[model samples]
Target: MFLLFSCSGAFSEVVMAREKATGKMVAIKCIPKKALKGKETSIENEIAVLRKIKHENIVALEDIYESSNHLYLIMQLVSGGELFDRIVEKGFYTEMDASRLIRQVLDAVNYLHSMGIVHRDLKPENLLYFSPDDESKIMISDFGLSKMEGTGDVMATACGTPGYVAPEVLAQKPYSKAVDCWSIGVIAYILLCGYPPFYDENDSKLFEQILKADYEFDAPYWDDISDSAKDFISCLMEKDPEKRFTCDQALEHPWIAGDTALCKNIHESVSRQMRKNFAKSKWRVSRRDVIFLYHILPKTNSIAAATLHCHGHPHGD
Candidate 1:
């Protein structure tokens, strides 16, 4: 009943299925064994990052089933399709709609950064919609280029699309979650002006414009957009990575501050609810199986350390 999701990096297809027993609809992502076998470590990292997260704006992993080689993730599927298509058809968002979408996307990014996962690729294509209504919910999907930092060393990956990539990322400098915000700025610019701030027929010229950080504004577009919106985008798209607001800080910007209660609820866990579900599970395991669960986990670090089996084997799922 639904179309497949296709992008450059992911050969994996999205399949619509109904559970035989419950007759419930599911959107399943299939990564064939051959396609992922050579990239086992990356697949594991994606799974690890996705599992650590829980939020309304971030795509949820409903279940994960793995075979000897392939891995399948059943996720919450949004029916409204990608924001890129919307932009293509309608041109851009009005100020009111842009505010709502930015708030939702920031909430998701803040949660991910807090969990030590950097969504290396954040673009219009990666933002999915929940329905056709104007107030439709949004989510971040496609974890193929995501990464988790485990060490003190900063990451150095020449990834991300041209127009939205941060200066640090394009310069091949070590960078962090700030790169995602750079893309957010680009999105805001498009939403307000109905065009990207930087574009060129030549790839080199496009990179120059991105690094130059020059954006266009005319009374027609700028007069209607609030300063809070412009300032928030400017603060996030700052040239210096350190100066840019972390996802947490950006969520509190004047444009989105009123809705922080929505963000707070996402990180708050209901252990009581989880324990109740655990009791109902047919597959039982001992407390020892978990080894240990951290009572408190901050946003900047991980909840647990890597485990070593008695026979000297590394294991994490």
Candidate 2:
């Protein structure tokens, strides 16, 4: 027995539920079978990946059930809300705070990479706080885009959210877990400046910028950011995946390990920009399927565009 709360999003109904047997709380992802047509394999893949992983910073897939009409996924309940929201609510934020957050992500991602898994999508929307506490840890959710390596298949899928996707993914290059590192760089950049590293109103133009790794630490916004912070992001966002920093390398950077990450409060400017730039319907585009259909499909022929529209589409969700 479970009590269904309000639906969380339009794509899938992620409602808060309380288990009657154990009196425990959880999040249940309700997916209608009709919506899963032609997407069974993707759902199976996501389940397999979630089943294999166990990390403190990753949302745990507690259980799964299949009724006559729907597939139910029981997940860890994380109510601390989104990462940006937490930062915006804080009265004092600093480079050190951002670095601490990034460090946790890097540590979790490093664990995933060690297990031959790549989190193809690592955007802000997917990073959630574990609980409604001041010290709540960040938890990485949404494994629909994750791919496990050593499965005798090359990870060449042009997947992941556009603004946060890696350069190679946009270029349709055969990529590695390094793609996750690139995303971390993008996240780190945003954490510091409160905006995306690469952005353009036009989708094609946005892809071009990501393809070229075209981004700048612009003036006023970056004036107060530490040089080490910039360098750390530069290493992760390097155009060449070969040259990009690994999670291990990033963890050792002065910004994360040493004293380079300044303690100066930057909440006013960073939160202001974050609120303006990430307002609803402005930057949180949940149309990864469209990107797959219109852009990635034509460039790479391995994956069919129709199949890419499934609930497992890597762009979001």
Candidate 3:
């Protein structure tokens, strides 16, 4: 009963397959054996992480099967679309709305960290809606870069989308699950202002900005954003990972748990900026390119070099 499908990456495609007997639809990631030649461990790590995670805000892996030349990973189908798309479409967006979204993400990442799993790559594209319903909860997807802690040395990979990566990661310093918290802060900043905290077409400049933790809540775009919201982002985006707010601390902050997230509608400004900044073509950079550039940059370079085009929309509603 495999019918509908969509290409998700270079090596694997996600198909909406239905179980014949149960008549339930699920997303099946099909990976060709040839594609697994040198990346077997990465695939195994992703599967291992998916298998153990059962949070409501995180996608679930239902089953796994191997064919003669392919491996199939059955994942819970999520169809609401990307987080940015929904925010851009909403007519009455506010700080409260952004707060709620970040809260869900924080809770999910918190659960992962507690279990010793670090989601090294957390970005807007990976946050999907469970269904098309207006009130559907967000679901986290794409754990290909995630790593379980205590299994190996501390993570020092210069990975993650350029705009949202933590400073420690860009500095090539050993990092913890705090990297996920930093990404959440970046997302929160964009949700309120309708643009990334850091942006530059040049990979070097972009990495330089992130490495220095250089960003601002510029006027007009951030005029309506509450101070509490800015404070919240600052805490998570702290240059020192050791001082960066943990998921638990972020959740307890007034902006998230209290009533500081303003209710004023900022959709006009926020959505307009979002559409201008996050066009489909601009978000098409390959993940492989980012990783490749990170590994090849000279150790003495001013900053890690990596082009970051962004965004992804999940198929199957």
Candidate 4:
């Protein structure tokens, strides 16, 4: 067994190991029984959800083992690292590239939705590449916050990374699988411009911005991005979940399915913005702040319906 880096959760650690007979490398997530005192259901939920999912763009959970002290989850080992890091390292990036990546995510998400699963948390950090090879595929990981929507049930959990969260979720409303589509829109926005659509120094202000669907495609950064691409994002980020594009709709959008002739090298600008965003620690703070706020915020529906009424203009005007 080789000790890989630790996983994200406070209760579990992920390590890479080799199968004795087959010599196949795999990732083992070890969750201490003690740490699951009140959250045993969460672990069971994750296992149940992951076991039901099988897609090229989603990670696979192969086996499970339990001991008196810990439970080990064996999974596919993905070595390519985070999607954004790979994008930053690339010399050439374009809408076509972004479209391909988003398409994979959409495919995985569509499959999940078909299975009545909602990935509440969808963000760049959770997207990983299968390997370091050039042809590596993107794989969605980290299903800790995913929900299995059963028959006649509604998902009331307002759980997700703040900036990428849907407006309905921030409003403390019971949401549907549509929330995952909203997150994909946020990811698409970042992929095109190399910065998040909604951003603020203050957490409350950030939440407000997301709630109002207040985001813009600023100059220089978005000047070269395709109009069709903007339209695709706008449809996904619609304030009203009822109007937001489903995964199938997004996949069929013009930007993703239409022209692919304008694949320009956007690496310099994208990488520059990525470095700036990371250097300022905005993304890190947003992650921490969202978790803090998700628990402390009032459960009442405080956001008015008017605040959630953003014009879903295709051009993002």
Q: For model 3, how does the per-residue alpha-carbon lDDT over 175-285 read when each residue is reduced to its tens digit?
A: 889899999999898899888888888989999999889999999788878999999999999988889999999999999999999999999999998898887566644
Location of the lowest summed lDDT over 10 successive residues in candidate 1: 285-294
My TM-score estimates for the predictions, one after another, are 0.72, 0.88, 0.88, 0.86
Using lDDT, rank the candidates from best to worst: 2, 3, 4, 1
Measured by lDDT, the strongest candidate is 2
Candidate 4 stretches with Cα past 4 Å from truth are 1-10, 279-282, 285-317
How badly does each model clash, as a count of residue pairs?
Answer: 0, 0, 1, 0
lDDT of each residue in 1-317, candidate 4, tens digit only = 32333334445655555564465666677676877787777777888888999998888998888778777788887778778889999988888899989999999999999999998889987888888888789989878778888746577767787788999988989899999999999999998878888888898999999999999989989999888888899999999999999999988888877785258988899889887785565565223101100011122323211101111111000
Error of 1 at 97 (Å): 1.7
Q: Which residue pairs in model 3 clash with each other?
A: 283-310
Worst 10 residues of 4 by lDDT: 308-317
lDDT of 1 by residue, 84-168 (tens): 4454444333456666788889888888888888887787657778656666798787676788877565788787766778889
In the order shown, the candidates' Cα RMSDs to the true structure are 15.8, 9.5, 10.6, 12.3
With candidate 4 superimposed using the best TM-score fit, by how many Å does residue 53's alpha carbon deviate from the native?
A: 1.0
Residue 257, candidate 2: alpha-carbon lDDT: 95
The list of candidate 3 runs beyond 4 A from truth reads: 1-10, 286-317
**Model 1 CA lDDT for position 44:** 78
